[model samples]
Target chain A: MTPTKTAPQNDLPEVYIDDILMTLKYFTDEHEVHLKIIDPQVCMNCESKPCVQFCPVGAYRTQDGGTVQIAFQSCVECGTCRVLCPNSNISWKLPRGGYGVAYKFG
Target chain B: MSTKEKLTFDVIVVGAGLAGSAAAAIAARNGLSVAMIERGQTPGSKNYFGGALYTHSLLEIYPDLWDRKPPLERPVTESGFWFLSKDGMVRATVQGGKMQNDPIDAYVALRAKFDAWWAEQAKKEGVFIIPKTVVVDFIREDEKVVGVITDRPDGEIYAPVVIICEGVNNLLTQKLGLAKHDLKAHASALAVKQLISMPAETINARFGLPSNEHGLAASVMGDVSMGLPGLGFLYTGVDSVSVGVGVTLEALTKAGIKPYELLQRYLNHPMIAPMIAGGRLMEYGAHIIPEGGWTTMPKLYTDGALVAGDAASMVNALHWEGTNMAIMAGKAAGETAVEAHQKRDFSAKSLSAYRARLDKTFVMTDLHQYRNLSHFLKSRPDFMNTYPAFLNDALGMFFSGFGKPKKQLYKDILRSLTDRRPLVKAAGDMIAFGRTIMGF
Candidate 1:
């Protein structure tokens, strides 16, 4: 079968920054956010990383020199990479309770 | 924490499946003290589906869920509809890899693990979750619901509002007269599923998976139903594959065909057998799905109480959408509860907002759009009969090279169409199908 190319229509709004800021205040203390933010260099650069393309939310983006950066706040906890990755480098877990995507329509 | 036998909540949600957990999480996050009750050993243990979690509605609740470690089996990159006859398949597929990028797209999930995680999220938001406790009935006061009566000793937990997110076995909803006592078998479907264990490498090779990506295949057997209104599905899980068939109880009973036999035949199909070859059955289970769509939706809200999820029969069969509707309805109910609490009025009038919200959401909108489909498909057996065979025969003939002239082959295919169904009737059926099932 020929590979089908389709546009990704499900991009998250840049306003996600605001939603994350609000959810952080409601569900967690600033200390937790600070602790999680300490690891800015967590992404180990891999040539064939599936997360860059497989993340349903488009949360992973490659920056200058191929460094992988994740917008941690927008993660929905779908656990796709945890099971898909052959290298098993992705540490997957649910967002801190009461904090991530609140699926209104699941 | 005070276990003083006295605690009140803004909302009491029963059943911690997709709907219940979503309701509790959304309500509590809005700053309402909520209580989620589950009867299962854990949430999701009792729930199952062809099991795709569509993100459109879930995105409203968890906008950033795609970025998080979601409880997803595979990011579905390919979706197709298959009309299968004895030896032919008519297929239509939209190969949009970009469609999976939407944070709110669908995800394959197992209810057992997913529900537990959802319940935990609700609890983290201070939503008191009482698991292993069954809500026996709604505590009605003066013809209005006030709280719930649970199986727990001294388990009369009172709340101003209650939302029922129970799955298809809606015992309480029926008891409360919210829904009819006995549903028409046509309004429901009995699905028997098997989880077949297979090696990951083999699965990837068979289904053509790219690392974590997955594929879904749904087909309708022309004669497998034995003239019943139903379909079959095969979804790829991480280590196991889920295969099943669901027939309407009315059809199954009328035909007297055992569901297991139908499933066995489906598995034995030439096209399906090779895919599941060498796989061992790890689990076998059956469940009921509300196929009633919009017509079967009960009076959704009452004084001080609301009904959400499958309890309301909010399933859209056209796109095989359920879990997202359940979660969306739960969120809407939660928001309504917040509104009612703020006004200090949990009357049916105040809770009617839940209905209004559903109308605006895809749950009700999509169901209403396909409202006539279930009945249409039932009335027209061609969907399960002539169409699949036509597809199969046409393809079989087109691929067959018996040295027949191309002109004669085209004529032969046209003759086959008229032989199975009159051209006029087929055209009419196609038009009706497009209008109803396709939501045109």
Candidate 2:
């Protein structure tokens, strides 16, 4: 019952980050920002700003004046930002029960 | 029930994922009251995996798992790696006839569906599942874990033994000083996946499979990660496919690429696009994999507490195995708990049996064998960048040598090897690869 080999020619598909996020279901906790920027000044001084690039959902975005904005609504809770932020500026905690991304087919 | 009895149990298993469920079920079946805590709305709502479940470990918990007809997607029959170089791929696969028979090797599964089903089975075994609750910290008494403090009101539940099956973000493990520190970017991998919806017939056709029941689990290395230390994977589900890439967090950070973008490049690759062409995106998710291996594993046991699964860094990264290790370790921890209760001693010395039990199984054996691997791979960037492309180029030359002399073709392949790397460096690569595999 193994998969057989086959070669086929097809056009490559285009992917949009926002379009991908649209397909997911999230029970947003309006009151709680489970993900927080512990020190905005620390983030501003941090040059690499790795969280802006490494976050899977792009929840952390840089504003015009150099501060980072967090759209915690879209967070998938991978916890990468908490660990990868060079300054350890992000305070991350689990969302309240039933209040985060609920994968339908994970 | 008395208030004391209502708030107490023999064991409290945290996280309700594969490991926690397995631990609760085994302990409850052994006549110990078990409470399993889950932070998700349901057991698997907050969980994600690489989409394959090995049957050997599950069989340890449910001997007749296949007969039970679990919510498994498809039995994986063909499994292999697709060595990719930007525009081309060289596939290597293994499909044994016996692997397709009874007691199948592995099955592709969606964690949401499969883990929910697994938790239900645990409940049936008399395990109390507390859903929609997060265990924030351990309730300790005299430096021994006596209970857990959750987010819910009056949520302190006392248990002599606590098993932490919490996944890769092991805050509790760190708090207990089990793990040396918070996970470093280099020590963990962030994987993002998209579940693509397609008809079963379309899936079968695209994959060149004989029937809907069989599936393929193919992992792509080399250019899939843009020559980075990561991999792309495609696992066939019943009516869909799971396509994803897992790259070390440090690699992703250093390269300045979003994980989803890396996944996008993999999806658009020439060798992969065709298989998933007409499918619609269903859901997207991300999870961190503990890649610290044996070197950074948290202390497995403490007085009245034990750690299992990703919390203990039990993943065998080389084989792409975590769930199986989690399940087996959980079962072993459950057995150890049973022994501890009988002895009426919950000291760390008594619970050291948990590690002894794992030592007898593949969980500890394989981890011990590959203890040096993560460090080896992390330092050797050329293994992913130079070797794969060189192999592909040499294969292309050999396959396209229709009118060329055989001697010239052999020389051409040798020239290609020296063109990318010095012969000495190539030999060094071989030795390093051998050491990685052979543990020399």
Candidate 3:
């Protein structure tokens, strides 16, 4: 089923990522940028700002009443924020082979 | 010399996931030179899913890989489905090894480990692999397909044929004009999953498996997806259990629910909380799943190129059958590439033998049979929310057997069904369900 969104279900889970990242591994030359917002203006005008709410891991968050702030450090690369962005504000690229999160159990 | 001038290999397989790796292996094993290009540091590092690799297709591809102790969590010997409401849960179960003389041998292996291992097998069969490279576009010559252009300097790699298995979101397939550009939310489902660590004994005990044995792929529906036509899953790994939920992007946008909260709701469901109470959160992942089935699948073959796996919209949403389809389609593409090479024909006609193989297999037939399911689901969005919840309530009350007699209980359930919606619409949904499943 295409999952529906609102009931204000976004109470964040009380899990810590610092511990999780300790066990995970990766083999990239450096932690380079892979995801970027295409248009700052598009994000500023988004009323619903669906991308902020729909991302599974909260990679995106609201800054002030308008702008969007990104936390790429914990991004899981699910492509949810990119697909659900109502304003087409997201530009997602595949991380260079073996660049992102290394799943101990993907 | 430059990549353009140093042409080699007859075929280049793009992406090293299940489909690309399989295609590379299949073509190379048949004595054709193949090069597999992966965008991740390794083949499966960027790959993720709440998935169980169905062994039947893999066994057909690599009969020997199974006996060599491939990195597998466990053979899912049991399975369960749940209907969850606010305070109620209803479950249906299937637990056994043999079903009608055939074994249900699905193993819950992590994709990172499985794909990496599977690609090694391709390497063993003389398939060359280049990792950490992204195929930015296809190298077009005289309007026919040739090879791929990667992110590296002078990254153009040329060949007579190229197979695209770059997964659900890669734009290379779109650039090649094999698939529609800008895939919409309705065409895909979004998945959010977490790996939770626990003791192997604890996993077995909680999931009701024999000591030192594996568990089942447990899936639940109703409220977990927040009313989208989607479901939640709990898969038992060797020392961890993966729990998550998925919904279509359109549904997710309309409902405005966050994916993690839906996951939290599933984890905290009355039936699920106890199973992973003391576990540690190990990993989190999200990916777009192709759900358009057969009706919306892109063209399978074009001049000098073939597309397979999620990139071609080759997933069966109802059965959660992506990996199996990917492997089979990849195999077909490999064989077809070999045939095209032998005949020295790189046109769409030569590569279309892949389509014939797919049409004759379970992949295409099953997809064609269930093509209308996504639309039917959209028509009755309540199938995920209101109806399933009602089913739970009705069944709960009927079985509660408080003070009412059986006849009185039957009447109550009948009245309740009509109380929710117009009886005519309910009947239409019922008919739709039957017709969709029966493939009418």
Which candidate achieves the best lDDT against the true structure?
2
B1-440 per-residue lDDT for model 3 (tens digits) = 34356656799999899999899999999999999999877878878998798888888789886476678787787777888886677877687636212445688879989889989888998999999888888877888988888888778888899999988885777787777656667868888888899999898888788854556787878877766778888889889888988888888878777666667778877778898999998877778888887766888889989999998888887777989999999999999999998899999988889999999999998998888877877778778877878888789878786887889888788777778767798889889988986678
TM-scores of all candidate predictions against the true structure? 0.78, 0.95, 0.93
CAPRI classification of candidate 2: acceptable
Residue A78's lDDT in candidate 3: 68
List chain A TM-scores, every candidate, in order: 0.56, 0.83, 0.70
Please list the residue runs of candidate 2 whose C-alpha ends up more than 4 Å from where it truly belongs after superposition.
A1-15, B1-6
For residues B1-440, could you state the per-residue lDDT of candidate 2 as single tens digits? 23554498999999889899999999999999999999998999988988799899899999988687899988999899888887888888878777677778889999998899999999999999999898999888899999899988788999999999989889999988888898867778898998999999999888888898789999877877776777788999999899999988888887777777778878888888888898899999999998877877999999989999988888877788989999999999999889999999999999999999999998888888888777777877777767778878889999999998999999999998898889998898789878877766
B249-339, model 1: which lDDT tens digit per residue? 6565455344555676677767778989999876555566788878888888888788888788888776788888898899988999989
- Give the lDDT of residue B258 in candidate 2: 71
Instruction: Show the lowest summed lDDT stretch of 10 residues, model 1 chain B.
Output: B252-261
Say which candidate scores most in DockQ: 3
Query: Which window of ten consecutive residues has the lowest lDDT sum in model 2 chain B?
Result: B1-10
Candidate 3: residue B27 lDDT (0-100): 97
